[model samples]
Target chain A: MRLLSQARVAGSVLLLLLFSAFTLPLRASASGQVTPQTVAETTQCGHVSLQAMIDEAEAGDTLVVPAGTWQAPIRIDKPLTLEGQAWPVIRGDGSGNVVAITAPNVTLRGFVVAGSGKSLDREDSGIRVSAPNAVIENNRIEDALFGIYLERAADSVVRGNTILGMALPISRRGDGLKIFYSPNTLVEGNVMRDTRDAILWYSPYSVVRHNDFADGRYGLHLMQSDHHLIEENVFRNNSVGVYVMYGTSFELRRNLIAANRGPSGYGVGLKEASDVLMEGNRIVGNRAGVYSDSSPLRPNTTVTYRNNLFAYNEIGLEMLPNTQNNRFQENILLDNGEQVNVYGGGDLTRNEWAFDGRGNYWSDYAGFDANGDAIGDLPYISKSLFDSLIGVQPELRLFQLSPASDALDLAAKAFPLFAPQPRMSDPAPLTQPPALPPTPGLESPPTATNIVVAVAMVGVALTILAAGLRRSKRQRRAISAQPA
Target chain B: MNGKIIWTLAQKELRDALHNRWFLLYTIAFIGLSLALSYMSLAGAGIAGFAGFGRTAASLINLVLLIIPLMALTVGAQSLAHEQEQGTLAYLLAQPVTRVEVFIGKYLGLALSLLASLGLGFGIAGVVLALANGAGSPMAYISLVGQTFLLSLTMLSVGFLVSALTKRAGVAIGIGLFLWLTFVFLGDLGLMGTAITMRLPVEQLLWLSLLNPLQVFKMAAILDINATLDLLGPAGIYAMQEYGAQLRGVFLMLTALWILAPALAAYMRFRLRGDF
Candidate 1:
């Protein structure tokens, strides 16, 4: 009976080996090699057309395209994920979008999408999303008119994608990520370059963070949108860092806007935009740091600026005369050609320069403290005769600090009637520039001078204190007749 | 004004101020703070050596705007107030010196002292900054120093006027501190508060700024710093257009008027005084 049972086991083992050999090839064809058995609804496409496999896939299935270039526009109509096992390149022959997403809950990840149609009017994109809640992540798109175009695709996520556009002129090129009428989208961790605009058009309640936008016309161009959160993005070498128009209640924080030197060349431009909470953003090396044209809607409404660093710009903050009720506090205005430039004459005095005994650090503030208080004993006033000339002519800025200008300033000083009215004033101006957190992508190497100066300052204070104590003791004892 | 009598009284005033340790303190404070500020500005950038001309000039501007005015105001107020309190004015008046001569003489002495202190303080700071940062723009820095002196003159005039108004040295000192606080600190707060509470016109704000000599100095000196033009904003732009080539000249003249008007008022008060 033992011998018979052993023979049966050997036969069963042989049968199992034969069964595995016969079904493995079929399983490989049915499912992707990377995830053969783990994913129950995975369909692998190799040597066969991706469209054919996609057609065969059931709803809610995943189609894995492995390691080959496919030359056709793909359309997804069912709820599924088109995952690239080896970053499959989907090429288009200049007709329609390379990948058309029409179904809800569709995910297109790990793709190398390239060569969309060349017509600007056609709005051809590498991936066009028409359905809501679509996710386009970890895709590398190149040479496309529009990298990712979403129309009415609300609540979608487009993350971890690097989109490279062709070197077309600003007018000829399309946006890297174009979202139209799409609300509540989250765009994160994408590095987009050489596009007309990294983000274009309107998306209400969208969160765009951690994306690096470089060499574009506009890093983020939002129009007629409301309540958007844009933070921690690096916008460098763009024409305009961020062109926000008519956007209300937007929270723009901690963004690095640098080296945007295009025609408009603004780190952040606001036109008729209201209720903007711009905090902790570094507006560095731009032509104009923050340009606002009628940004405030109501007479009493205000856009707030707190703890922002405006450094190495031609003009730090330029606002229109109509832009009123704005507040600036705790911001470091450093090394800008102009700290605040208003056109056509406006009352910036209505705007609060300091709140709660704290104000911005103007690198040009000529104030000092004598009584050991860190606050400057005098207020820092900003006013320039040259500024007024430039405002009216917009041409005399060529001779900004020329000797002629200096002579003119000297003459103004000698003549009391020539003194121009001050534009703004900050009471309690800090003696030291606020110690700011390092900005990402714009951090400078550390230096040791601050420590040395701080130590020296402390030593001086100690000496002064000791001297004062000794003097007081002598005077008191002499007066009381208690000295030996 | 008798130049000989004024000159003689002015010499006496200068010798007294120098001997009293006030001049030393002022000059030392200016030097220490200016150097500290220059170093501080460079320290933040983590850059040693030269931070360029614009940056140092900018820092110096801050120093001048705050310290120069306060120093001038206190010294000017104290000089006259102390003389009146000690009965020296009566003695001097009895001895061939007219009240106008005493007033002009004291003003001249105080102005020279302020100028010397400003020059010495800034000169030392400038040399130190140049040594540390290589060389920036000497002309601009010098121009800034000069403008600060001009600001000092205006504050001195304000001081003299205050001294002439008050009878006691203590009162003069109190008023001096109060004026410094008001013009340099509280004035801005009040203006900004009024602007918020009452949406004052840009023109009105500019006019109101003229009430403070420090503001007058700032408006004039801001043109010297390239970076400050942008901060001048639209109103400044408007002024630039209106003032044109005369902008600086007008500002200087205005600041001078700030000096001359108050000094004249103090002289008139002294000339009319029956207490002497």
Candidate 2:
């Protein structure tokens, strides 16, 4: 396999070679194995000569489809590459799957794979991969049990694809792209619409990035999965943007979520989820944003919410009663009905005011910036002010709803909005924003704080290692009946 | 005089137990297995819900599986038959020790030591899990230990009863394990199979399933003791409630039998025998 892959790499384009060259061992050079392994053994599939195409295919052959309409399911049993020539169309005969890749290393690309949804037992769908390492990229998928279903497949990559799901589920069972018991998968640069879930991870170590997910029951969901990285995905008009339950370890960063609503679900729901680090995501305009409330499994869940923007949601934040050991820090909360609707539980600390009157902006703040430096002199204690006014006198809620009101005017001028916890601020707020590269992607720029967070993790890891070694020495002494 | 003789007999039984090599080896094996299950739970298994799952009053559900038989076979099966076969019973009986004294002494030594060993193993496993796991309340730990002790005592009584009834040690072991294995796996399985096989009314099946000892234990384990469920159907929310209550009663009755039946059998057999 090493010799074969090396031979293939030698035949690959310069950029492909560059990516592989650094990581791959030099034992299998292009000089000996590249052309024969990759180029010579390619499977060219077509309706006219199916048997001939199958014959041309070796164990690890590449099946290349030219740009033409083929009315059949492209079935591959062995290890083979099924590459398309500039978006070739694979139209099904109102039957089962458009393509079924059974063996490993089968790559499908640049095709309009459509027309599934036949029998209830046998779902009509775009692609069904039963094995690992099957790359389905740059393809147009429609009307299926799943756009790309990796049933129990592992280590696959689904990227740069435009996938549209069949409307409502049969018995509430439909997914745009789903993977099960799979790890190290990369789902990136995809446009998904009208799907139950844009991406779903089962067992974990999957990476989802830079995808546009809209009009789905849930944009992204994690269940019984671990160590997944969900980065820079845009979730729009979904019932629930992200629903994580069971056991999940996700690194959620730099995602834009907006205008999602649910009767019972959340914009970002964490139920029974554990070990999550969510940072730098823009969350807005949901029935409720960031619901980290209680579930039966809440006792085991711990998540860190940091450096994100939470604005224009019905409820800014919710901490349900059963939740524990969760920390919030350095985030902005602006323009919401209730800024912090803590459900009589959970812990919060280390958050900064986006614009304290001392430099924070609460949209509803009555304090003034006398120095004209875009900051008020006093702090904002959102919890206390709300409690004193609306909580004590429920009727004052309607009275203060007006932007410009009567007796409320005197209250604002007299007192400072006392923030519950002390704010952790940037000593040097940007006078003028620093110039950054004009990159066109959802991915965030690697900031100094992000780097420090990463470095601090390494430092902690080293400390743990040292402690572990010492503990081992002590255990050895105890076991040998000697004092350390 | 009778009391002194009984004391001497009890001492002799304890000495015999110490020398029983197979008994010692099997005890080690059981310890190893329980330890392994504890290890698996702390690390994380998909089925940790069922794996090494012990609660305050219910882990006795697993008792019907192996522990009961283990206790029964080690002491109950071989107690009389082995002594008779080795011709030691004749020699002991020739002395002033009455049959009642001999029976009490033998039963106490076997029951106490076996129960103690089982308790120690359970304690060790609980400690290992507590040390390794990231979190678990002390209440949960105490609950587990308490339940384990209760189950061990119940099994010990059952073993004693089995020992009394038969001259053939193997038969006694078989009978002891038979009750245990039936309750552990067979009873629940039979009930489930009956429900599935006979297109019986769901409600009827629900009522009948209460008889299965395994189901009772499972109910106790799954639903702790704060409250009880009362079912009215074969399946669904209401049925789950009913099954809970029914299983609790069943486990309690079965455990009582473990105590009453074995001791009664030994007493009757000892009284009827003429060898002494």
Candidate 3:
């Protein structure tokens, strides 16, 4: 009996230590909401009002909301945890913010927040968090003017949420997730579609990773933000994939920016930015893969593009005439309409096309590697006469693939007198393309139907040819046998 | 025009074309070269699998642009000029058939032969591509075939105009080749040079480009394959923006106008001329 009592006391002490380990962070962040409350108070409001539960609860109290459509324009003033048993709906009255969190350490998850006001001036949103350390995760925000607005919410986490903006005209629609003055915010694994822009304004040290932004005005528009890391995100079919204006020390890695084809269809546009590093990106099928306009504005700052694949774009790299201090190295510029075009009538000689004796692989580079060192013996020069003319007069690009343009270039090469000056030259261009990470989601292999169609077409063509020949031969034999 | 006389004349022309050694050789060469071109395009991409129909068709665009018009012009030019040179056209003209009937009949026969050659070549190439790689969407390939057919018709109409004006087969063929060269190179180069020198407005440039039947076919083919005129650059984008949903239809109409204008001119010249 004495030994059994001692063992029970030891187990109780261990349980207490484990419980405190879990609760201590919450107790410290919640600002002295230390009373441990058992039994998460089920909301008495049911479908009527979740705000009543928030009003009745103390700081750090966890409220369990049942699955029902609740009227929003709700506010959480104290630090609280609102957990939905199922995905509950919070429908706004189309006036102001739908679900507002004004208290620090508030956690909102497992809810479908919808129908905010259409007022861009008021900055209406489905979930507006003004307090720091807010966790807004796994909730689906739909048909809201602004999906999620994080205003001054430092160290906030916005994860795994699906934000679909209102179907207004692109200019009229608000941002999907507008992070204003929110420092060190982690926006990861979220999807934003059909929004005007996903704006990161003055949000320094933010990490936006693994998100998908598509069919918007600007996929990720960063303005005056510093030291942001955007990695492994997909920005597709937007007007501009990622436009960085006046940002410093931005790193974009392994992101796929594709098919942005709007008016200013840039996969990644940099305007007066400095110290930007874009590495390992697959920028494909865009109007211009990377557009630089007066980038690296400050002296001694540099913008570097390394190991990116710029494929099938109209212009792989388009820059302003005076844009300088940009370095492009170890990149594969494959089959763009024009590899690099300096917008207006100037050359890209100011920017460095090679660094450390390594240059990019130009698909149109005609030089061969004689010594098998994988470097071209002749320098890769961009001096096509037609390309230069098209740069001056873009409408002449209509004849880009015409025989006339080919003949013009051929004549220029033969005559050498008519050839324009080199726009830019890489001293050591790679004869072979550099290795690139395999693109995700390649097309499936040919199906049986594809084979059948191909065989049938070939058969038909050969049969026609055979029939024609046989008919002609018979006609000749008949005429010859008739005794002329 | 009497349908019976036209049919009889067309049958004669068709039989002659099929019997011609040069025509046979040209058809074989076209088919062989097209297939080889498709193969090279696929292999050149360094891809292990077959490229999609869009890519294969794109690679064939330059070859088609170079060859189809030349073949059509040569065949059409030889049709009337060779017969006239041998005095057989005069013998045929003395028959009950009218000049209009003979003209329409010859055009119809050559059109059928050209269609057969193009169909055989592209169909075989497309089938091989489908079997080898995969046909992502056959619409672009089908569109390319249709555009080439229209281009052949347009060039053949222009060839008939040349033959109507010329007497000797050598002279007609030479003129046809010259016109082919002009259509292939001069128009685009002249316009590009002019645009560069004078800085022509995009609208005017588009209009000038549309005047060239070859450019019309190229733009239409590219637009159909890419589903956007962006590849054509600013003039193409201007066309897209200006024409909106009517861009493809406009190109088709332009190609038709090209065919009708030349065919009409040839008919008028053949009717009014007293050379026979």
Candidate 4:
């Protein structure tokens, strides 16, 4: 009986220790909220500077900045949590970073950071983090050279941040979120606009998702990055949507890159990038849907375009003619002026237009399918002697679809010598356009004018036929009345 | 081969055409349609005036394709068939002119009337378009006019062949309309339908285009514009490269042959039959 009582006492002690381990932090945080300081001594109240409070507090302390504008650059050199009660504004002196996190394991949340220097060389930012494992979330940053500059800040998380830049030109303004050598970073739910770019410079394995980047020079500029996942982002009204230069093994999925009209306007440009898988992305209303140059570093690289909807672009898929092993499958190329225009004078036969049994759905395909097969009976061949001649002489594009061009095509057919090679062919063409998600506010159907014209033509033809029949019948009667 | 006799017969035929008011009717139609289409092209897309002239040529091509063939065939067929039915051909053959001379004279006179009609119709449009587009590729516009002329000649020859084969004026006119419909509309549809059903090689489709004179005209006009060549697909590019400079010449020769062979056959049938 004595030994059993001793055992019960030991079990109770163990349970008590576990309860204290879990509840102690919760109780301390609760108390800390009431008085705003429990772990370390901080400024009580009154009008004390934020720097004074930081200097007085311990390294691991929590400082709650009051609901007022903190002046100039606030340097955080300790592992601390600077939480704001009512979104305290940290107004910079227009010289350097407004809030620079130089120490690791720091969290800066619920603050409005603004006003950095205009010098691009110094790399001024609203919130600049040089330390690893820092979290900068729920912050409203504006009027900054760079919104959030993370230099060597590996494994950091910058989420739910709204980054807005000044009204300067793209060349003068810094990026919305510039990550240099920051690997394994998660940049999510950031709304950025009017910035130079959302850049990833040598930032490998970064996951940039659900961000809205608009009205910038480049929506997302990736330079020498590898193995990045950019998904569900909307890049609208930028100069270039996603400029992937020297990027490799990137997964660009379900993103909408649209209306990016500029000098070298491209929805997505892949320059020497290899092993890029672009799928389910709608690249619309740009000069070039996807401008692909040769992957010179990696020869015989296969860049794929799968399930993409390329629409209303000036030139869709403007790639170098010698870009070998590039495959396009199940893409809806709808209403592009030139569906596929080659940059140089070389054969594009090496690029595969269809993979497996399915090819792209061209909006202009006129072939019909009998026997209820959804695939076109013949291969969809996209070529034009006019397109070829316009490639050489651009002004001839003004005479596009002219009868003279049609005559030249007839001439090409009559004489085998003038026949140009097909630009591209889809072996298994789809009868209907694939059901892509409707873009909001841009659901433009095919022109009603063309349909009206066709109907008018049929009506005219029927009328002409009826008139001719009557006249011929009258002529028959007249002939019968006359001597045979 | 007597130049004086051929000239006299041609003059008589031209006078007969003028008296029948066929030339005036065709001239009015060509001018009216061409002007209306040109104005519509200019007014379209909100780009009024000179900017639209470049676009006008493209819009008028279909009109030319539809109207010229019907006019050419009906006139050519009715002219010869009506003469034969009236026994005027027999009277003319009884004169010093040979049957070959009669055929050539009639064809040349018909050709002159067609040229006059087409020239009046397109010449006004060309001048207006050139002024509007500010001297837009006049060469291209001229080429379209030239193709229309060739197409008309070819259709006229086809009408001659139909008229020569039959005796009744009504039968000749009916056959001429059928030929017009077949060549202008049905020939392409049939070839395309066959191609789709049978999965014919594009090369075969390319060569088959030569068989129809109107198709030859269509292809020639389309290929003259650089962008339309891509619509021809890859085979067109292959054809362009293979033939290079010879492509245009080859099509022109093919069109010329379409004119000559039918007329020659009609002349031979006329001479051998001696029915007139």
lDDT of each: 0.73, 0.57, 0.81, 0.72
Taking the tens digit of each residue's C-alpha lDDT, what string does model 1 give over A1-484?
7556545654554444345433231112212222232222222333455676667676655555555677669888888877775677888887768999888999999999999987888898989999999999999999899999999899999999999997788889988989998899999999999988866457899999999999989999988888899989999998799988876888888889987874467999999888888898888767789998887774556799988888767788887877767888888888777788876654467677887888888877887889866778888887776565555545344334333345455656788688878878888787766655555675422224423333443354344333323334444678689655
lDDT digits (tens) for residues A1-484 of candidate 4: 7556545654454354345422121111111222222222222332445665566555655555545666758888888777764677888878888988999888888889999998899999999999988899899999999999999999999999999998897789998889999999999988898989899998899998988889898899999999899998888888899989996788888888887766567899888888888888888767678888874337655788888888656677777775767888888886666788776544567777788877888766878788556778788887766567656544343333334456666777788787878877788888765555433223322223323333343354344333323334455688789986
Displacement of the residue B1 alpha carbon in candidate 1, Å:
70
Q: What is the iRMSD in Å for candidate 1?
A: 12.0
The model with the greater lDDT, 2 or 4, is: 4
lDDT of 3 by residue, A1-484 (tens): 6555545643453355355433121111122232323323333244236786678677765555556677888999998877664677889989899999999999998899998999989999999999999999899999899999999999999999999989888989999999999999999999999998999999999999999999999999999999999998989889899999997899999888887875578999999899999998888778889999989988999999898888767788888877888898989887677888888878878888899989989877889898989888888999888888778777788886678888988999999999898888888898877876654323544446655555555565455445434434556788789976
Reference-based TM-score of each model: 0.57, 0.45, 0.86, 0.55
What is the lDDT, from 0 to 100, of the residue A24 in candidate 3? 24
Q: Compare the candidates by DockQ and give the number of the best one.
A: 3
- Model 3: number of clashes? 1
Q: Which ten-residue region of model 3 chain B has the weakest summed lDDT?
A: B44-53
Question: Which is the better candidate, 1 or 2, if ranked by lDDT?
Answer: 1
Reported per model, the fraction of native interface contacts reproduced equals 0.01, 0.00, 0.37, 0.01
Ranked by DockQ, the better of candidates 1 and 3 is 3
**Model 4 root mean square deviation, Cα atoms:** 18.2
lDDT (10s digit) by residue, model 1, range B66-122: 677778888878877788899987888898767778888888867766766665676
Off by over 4 Å in 3: A1-47, A84-86, A439-460, A463-484, B1-59, B88-105, B120-136, B268-276
Q: Flag the better candidate by TM-score, 3 or 4.
A: 3
